[model samples]
Target: MEDGKLTVRAVERALDILLCFTDSSDLSLTEIASRVSLHKSTVHRLLASLEGKGFVIRDASSDKYRLGFRIWELSANMTHSDDPALILLPEMERLRDQLDETISLYVSDGLERVRVQAVQSNQAIRRVAPIGARMPLHVGASSKILVAFAEPEVQQSLLASPAWPAGLDKASFRQQLAEAKSLGFATSVEEREPGAAAVAVPILNRAHRLVAALAVSGPSNRLTLEKMMEHAPVLMEAARRMGKMIK
Candidate 1:
């Protein structure tokens, strides 16, 4: 292989390894190898390289790999430049107050959705999601909205996975996505979290491509399925307004 091509291949593989951290907080060498579709030795070699650069490190307590401080630093800096989280913060707060539920903003990362910003619900008994929570693309309302509006390949890859991840089943997830597409919105009722339900709508950019998802989540007892359906239009409107403000 040519030198430049070889370098690109290595870079891609390294990035693949880093991507494994999206859904996993810690994983062993064998687990990382399986997730990344690489041999154990290859994973070890790449991990050594990353560890040297302070991007990844093995947990001394559990011997599992976790992203390192250096990686967090880089991600923080990149977030500042992209400014997606910051741009959406004001709107998220508004949505949270209007619905009195957790409001979250998520962006696609490969086949997963990463929570970039989250506002906690004010109600005493409410659903709470942290800022860095990672969710499967097909599970919750927010994630599905993000996936439904994404490139076809991105949605197809998640459907084609041989084994579905936690909080989602393959066949049911496909059916849900189809419905979400038809409705031009997404919803989940007691699917992702127990006693929790949500409605989500896709945010699009000037190019009419998916940029993010805006979601409102609360306890199912309070945010009934009927009420969620009622609020679907509200979520869509917020998504549209946020999309316009994004770029």
Candidate 2:
């Protein structure tokens, strides 16, 4: 067989070994080799590779292997909304206290944006993006910011989607998304709710992937264009701090 074909066959066998643990978490080297119909020597080498990369660990006493911390970490982050909110809430509060405005953190759920964390302003009339609030991705500063910072394939699929607001101009929306990304922030005045204004920035992960949108919103009279622009830098910085805190 060609070297490339041998490599592919080896990978397939390695993956088969991994799948054996799906139904059972722990297995001996002999047991795994039997399950995958592979020789003991090849199975041992594959298990060593998996263990070296922290995908699996072999117990010296029991002579059995089980999944490792890397697998747990990946599973935990599969639901991005959970652990990240816990880490980001404190930073959101700090930004709210610093700016004296409503703070919100939203993550994309398919074509909709879900508010996972928020700190409402104590003022008499403030815009409230309540926790668990779900909004379409085609409108609002936070929504636009989330979609704009989304992965390229995701952004293209979302933009080409037909669920956008009626009479929405795709070209202008694309231009606005580009501007928002270039400027590192996005703003909307009375777009989502009447008498409401907001400025949003992207909350990214360690890989620089957009996980959420951090926004400060308030009554239009108080959060005017100039104020949102002035506070954009602060919001951007807060998002950066929150991203660093995400494990």
Candidate 3:
């Protein structure tokens, strides 16, 4: 066979291995080899390549293979009119009208939180997050939710940063993260910007891995912590819907 065809065959086989995990969360080398109908050695080789690219994760304890965060990252990068942003904008618009606030989607990038999408409130005074703007992961409702639900190693790395906000107690912050995870949503009052406040919820894929944080932001007086907590359910439901469509 030609060299190009050989490479194409390798690509197909690798993709097959990745697809096998859709039916099950974790698989062993023999299990994957059987599912893909390839030899164990070939499956192992493909999995190694996938692992190198962060496409798969091998648990040290169970010696099992599972999809990794890289898969979630690529899936979230899709763009089109009415895209991930589109899929959530209608719901966001409804939220904006109801709360008269800015609705946004935030995703973690390294140790930073980035605003990937947003729907602005029509009110003369409203919160806005420009697409691609980077915000401190430890500073706001959406930012905190993104970091709080992140994988443990990621959370540790973020918490250990020297840039942690002055005067904010780490112990109290840990308590807040615990509460947000327990309650399924988080709220902030002028934590990042003066006169600004927001509430956010985690968006998770079928694998239960966090995809992004969905948020509502506005002037602190209008988007009181109480009001945001009250709307938490609706935001959570919206997040649930958005997450279902991911991968």
Q: Which candidate number has the best lDDT?
A: 2
lDDT of 1 by residue, 89-151 (tens): 888899888888898888888777889888998899988777767777767898878777788
Candidate 1: residue 20 lDDT (0-100): 88
- Provide TM-scores for the models: 0.68, 0.66, 0.64
Tens digit of per-residue lDDT, candidate 3, span 1-247: 6999999999999998987865578999999999889999889999999999999999989999999989999978866643566666777788778767789988888888878788888888888667767777877888779878999988898789887778878888888898889999999897787999889999998789988899988899988878887889988888887788876
The superposed Cα distance between candidate 3 and the true structure at residue 237, in angstroms, equals: 1.2
Which scores higher on lDDT, 1 or 2?
A: 2
Model 1 misplaced regions, further than 4 Å? 1-81, 165-172
TM-score of 3: 0.64
lDDT of 2 by residue, 1-247 (tens): 6999999988898788877875576999999989998889989999999899898999999999998887888877675654777778778888888999999989999888888888988787777665767788888899889988998876787777877666888898899899988999999998877898999999887889888899999999999999999999999888888888775
Report the number of clashing residue pairs per model. 0, 0, 2
lDDT of 2 at 20: 82
Instruction: Give the top-scoring candidate (TM-score).
Output: 1
Residue-level error in angstroms, candidate 1, position 57: 15
**Would you give me the overall lDDT of model 1?**
0.84
Off-target runs (Cα >4 Å) in candidate 2 are 1-82
